[model samples]
Target chain A: MKARIEADLPFYFGPGRELFGFYHPAPAASGAAVLLCPPLGAEQIRCHRLYRQLAHALAEAGFPVLRFDYYGTGDSAGHGRDVDWTRCLADVATAATELRARSGAQRILAFGTRLGANAALDATDAALAGVVAWDAIADGAALVGELDRMQDALKVDLNRFDQARPELDVRLEWQGFETTEHLRAQLSVVGLPALGPRTAWLVSKGSDAVSEHADRQGRSVEAIDVAPRWDDIDRLEMAILSHPLIDAARRRLREMA
Target chain B: MHEQAFRFGSSRHLVGIVGLPPVIDHGVGVVLLNAGMVYRIGPFRLHVDLARRLNALGYPTLRFDQSTIGDSGAGGKLLARPEQVVADVGEAMDLLHQQTGCRRFVLFGLCSGAQNAHSVAHADPRVVGALFLDGYGHRTLGQRLRHYLPRLMKASVWKQWITRKRAASGPRPPEPAFVVEPLPGKVVGGQLADMLARGLKLDFVYSGGVSRYFNHVRQFRECFGRLADHAGVSVSYFQESDHTYVLRGDRKRLLDHVAQWMGRHFPVTRPG
Candidate 1:
């Protein structure tokens, strides 16, 4: 239980900024290190409790984990634009280094949700260990399309303001807010399947084709819907304390042994 | 949209569920090509709900995962080829006709599946019309190459031997299971893209062009456009919904129109 808690470990990537996170070092000889990437937009907000549960679970299991913010968001470096794949991946790399140096764990893994899953899978060609995705966004194009549909649903007409290639940056009367070109560019090429080495895909619920594709690729897949755990704020604290990943750290160490 | 389960090929035709029909036949049939990896999906179960709904409206439909993608599992690394899909549509039409004596049937597809449907409906006379949900155009290797640079560069990006893959990769809780390879010169690349290029996929056809995601959206549009001109027979884009925008009602309407078009085109001879 005397797990070392490193809050906001500052790690450098490029010349731009140092990304950070809170590392919960396991109580025993550590098993491995896991960097957790949160979801995108609102889902990020909704899954905070789940991430906490995941972090505590990993810690209890004896594998220290560092769940950090990308360059700009959270307690990390920059802004939303700073959250692009380039910056996000760098931040993840930096986090892995920090975990390895501090805990001397031989293995490491990337556990990501939604948009974060893209970064994780894309990291297959990176160093460290394997990657796992939770409801990973297999189709980046779909997410962009969703944003557009949501924009339409929101009644935002970017076309009304300027006739000739109107700048989407400037807030148009109809468009609720300016849409960023950076986010768009990222989504176009965003594909987890293209990323090297297949990553495990775990659906929160329902067994569908994506998971089947995971199986085809020889990746482990499990779909467990834990009664939709995010809504229980009062239970969030307790839930985090008894997370499965955290509970399996010692067993994870035994596997390594 | 509207469809009924009926029996055709002798009760000993294929697997279990001895014939009456492997599926409900309303004389109307649609060969659905899911984007890719259909075996992992519940196509008949998912779209069957829509079929059941459509059947209530006096129409019968069949939504089967193309060869390699779903339970049909007959292709190699990819799902059925364009020509093969066309052939399947042919068989499905015959099955529908023989079973219920309805001649009219439509071929409908979504994303990459749309391309399959388009190719089949154009080549075959039986499929009078087509319905495309999130239709796509085309794709060239060069365009794909340009898009893949970021990944290539990011791969060897370790500062010495210290770092490995991202730290966040770990096993996620599993999902429930109900459950459920390759030939030479078969398509292979980025896993999903290879699968799609081989056959079966979707894109912005399901999403928007947020600047961050604009590349994906535009690339998809370009790919869809590429395939459009070649879609010989006329195909209609009904109920265009973004990634989050799948309107069941609109999809139903699209199916209704498809059935009507089939009736006008194929002219099924009613049983005497």
Candidate 2:
């Protein structure tokens, strides 16, 4: 039985900008509420279907889940040209706020993919009972480098475009988002554990070195190599909805509250 | 986000299994990369056990078969090539990203797996860090010729050719070495320098079993400079630990050091 999806959700946390999201409200009393923050760029695209499925699955299991896009990506708002540091994180807090207000659930769980996971982990003031990252990009620089590596393989160099760098070291905005030296420095020191206290961490490794940081960080990190579907787009959306972990996460969120 | 099967790239099949501690969704993930081949962990269970223990400690882990081996997709040739392994790692990372919305990433592996983790972190600053390298070496063939010249020079050229072919292939590409002494031998100094230049500050602990390759710690000293420069990196050698910490022994110290070091560097948000 399909209830309804609360589309075009709006809320503000940090900068008070009207951020956007899509909410799935279940028919029965919810077990827990989950707010899913998608990774930047293509991960959002690749995991789109998965997140939707996760929302639906959680709803089926008595937990309400909401999946939404960040400031500059997807159909949310703002031109699709954001690369800023602060705005994205603010969006996370906003999403959490929206989930809490709309779902009216006691505890909130933030589930993110890749950069989205990093964003969730970076959030502090938000009242999230538990946080899970499908596979998180702990280092924003690494995600940039992974993309850079792909570009280099394809013979492209974006760093070279920063010619005025020597003249203008001021915070340069790539896309509509500006990255400040301060933000870069803050991000550099960031690890998953920085997400404040009483946080639940999940690092998905298909049994590989990707789990190294999880092992060291001592956060309850696990490697789940489930069938990875979805292409460059809608990957997280689809997995979060249909995957098996949603049930466990829903249970944890309920217990934490 | 438990034990799930997946195919990475076109050739390598990957599995993110529950470790000993079963970190569940919020755990450390380890991606095992075989030197010349991508092997499965379901049957062997060494990597599986490692993943389980880490899982028990709230660390999630994964190990996948590289391209052209096991039941994975087809990943061209040069299976264990640096770039190739990196690509497989990228795929696994993507999978991990899909399964867990983790912000921080760490790597722990052995042999080429360890080397791959180091290189990924070195090139990509985003890597929280890495821990591995049961066998560390630093030497080129030409440099070795000088040291072994007096003896190797006396050997026949035909014998040299055969030895070269065998040595070129990584020892125990698919399995751990049973015997510790009769090591497959390792290159020293120059060669190690060239390969490790790409690694970031990957903090790790090496067991004495890998001592067979290190004639002098100084030979590989240069590699540490770049690592030292990285933001969060540390490394040490556990003179007594083996490749895989034996379950019955006091192996927890090394891994615990890793866990503690992780606690000191990347603090996790404990359930408050």
Candidate 3:
């Protein structure tokens, strides 16, 4: 077994170079590049390690990979409140371009999890060769509802010993990240867009709706039981380092190539 | 503000971002440590927000991940997690010193990061100050009374107690996979005394998340006794904020408080 080389080059690109990303240049280029679109907020934090691992795996398998934080999140410029769904889509496109330019790979494949998957599907990029949607969100309203439930549950857990404080009349926010009214409206209307022929749907075992939706769209779906529960409060701090998911993504991208 | 990404360390695998101001005003830069497993951005991007704010105040800031965390790889030399963290942080200071000519530094952290900050500040003579959010605290008699008395007066508490007693006979909830043990009061007090004697400025902020062990402002005085009253020590207790400061308002309050504290104690000398 050879010791894997990690992504050594970290750079800023996109408009005003506001976006931060790590480029994992493949020792042997496969003529295809992988752009990892990360999930939003807390989900992004949970998946950070998994994404890094996936990037490494993809790079070793001969594809250059670029993983980045969308604007208003992570090391990128802007605050959490500035996060917009449309902006996320644009960032995905921008990152895909950056990855193509850096790797000199004509074919670009996007691998995104959760909301990131949705962004990849919706992004209008000419260079996108394929997409791997891992547990992609099919319904935006459902995600909002789930996040709201998690927020309420978190309050109950934090205030277990004391009486709950009066709810503050403030803008929509979940966990620590704030969502603008525009983004909330955008999320509420999110539904599965038409899947491309090269799209790969990797969903959790219990997510029958996503699989059925893909099947209805004449798209095949791979159900993996090892997918991390992104919204589980108990394992909020735990990183999603599921090897099965990482391997499945790598294999899926290789098949696409 | 200028932000630059860096990959430095012995193996040149450690990753960090340095936030620089247009004009350098202070000789002491700020270095942020990772809070638990979360990356260099810190929980809710707190480190990024803090670094930018500190830069606006004319102080350079570096937030980096420890080895095996975030983008950072394992060190070339094999060492335990504790020693690796200390070494990683020292290298961060060294990087800032080399890049920006910062002779002294202030360390800031939250939760586990706070523990690391305490460790590094104690070991490194170049650390001029350390700020800890929801850091170490032991339950003193005052804290225990403050935590329980309000609940004892509430009727809902007794009802919940009765409900829990009935439920306790049914089934036990699964034990947590991990538990955080609080540091001993005696040891923390002694460490604080030593740091104070060395003229290290210390700031402690307790949030509602740690209310079980630290509830009121005076709990600091009761927990650490004489050391809490030292001129070099300052404490703030925000009973409304959770451990991670999840709420946007809570996070803003935290950032503002931190900036003000830095301005007061570690005031940046303006360039002529």
Q: What C-alpha RMSD separates each model from the true structure?
A: 21.4, 22.2, 2.6
Fnat per model, in the order shown: 0.00, 0.00, 0.52
| lDDT: worst 10-residue window of model 1 chain A | A157-166
Off by over 4 Å in 2: A4-17, A155-190, A194-201, A206-219, A226-242, A245-257, B1-272
List ranges where model 1 is wrong by over 4 Å.
Answer: A1-17, A154-179, A194-198, A205-209, A226-257, B1-272
Best by DockQ: 3
What docking tier does model 2 reach?
incorrect
lDDT of 2 by residue, A3-31 (tens): 13322222222233334355667667555
Q: To one decimal place, how large is model 1's interface RMSD in Å?
A: 20.7
Per-model CA lDDT versus the true structure: 0.46, 0.50, 0.83
Worst 10 residues of 3 chain A by lDDT: A157-166
lDDT of 2 at A140: 53
Alpha-carbon deviation at B75 in model 2, angstroms? 41
At residue B76, what lDDT does model 1 achieve? 26
lDDT of 1 by residue, B1-272 (tens): 11222222221111000012233444544444443332211121224333443444444455544443322324323333655566555666666566556575555565455556646654565654455544443345644565456535653333212332334544334543222122111121232232234333222232231112223433543443443333222333321222212223333454465545544544444311
Cα RMSD of predicted structure 3: 2.6
For candidate 3, write residues A65-153 as lDDT tens digits: 99999999989988888898888888988998898889999999989888988888888763588889888887789888888887777
lDDT of 2 by residue, B1-272 (tens): 13444434433333233222223344334555543332433211244444544554555455666553332434545554556657777777666665665544676666666666655654443355566655444444432553355445554444645665789664423423222231122322232233345442355555544544432233344434343344443556654443433212324475467667655654544421
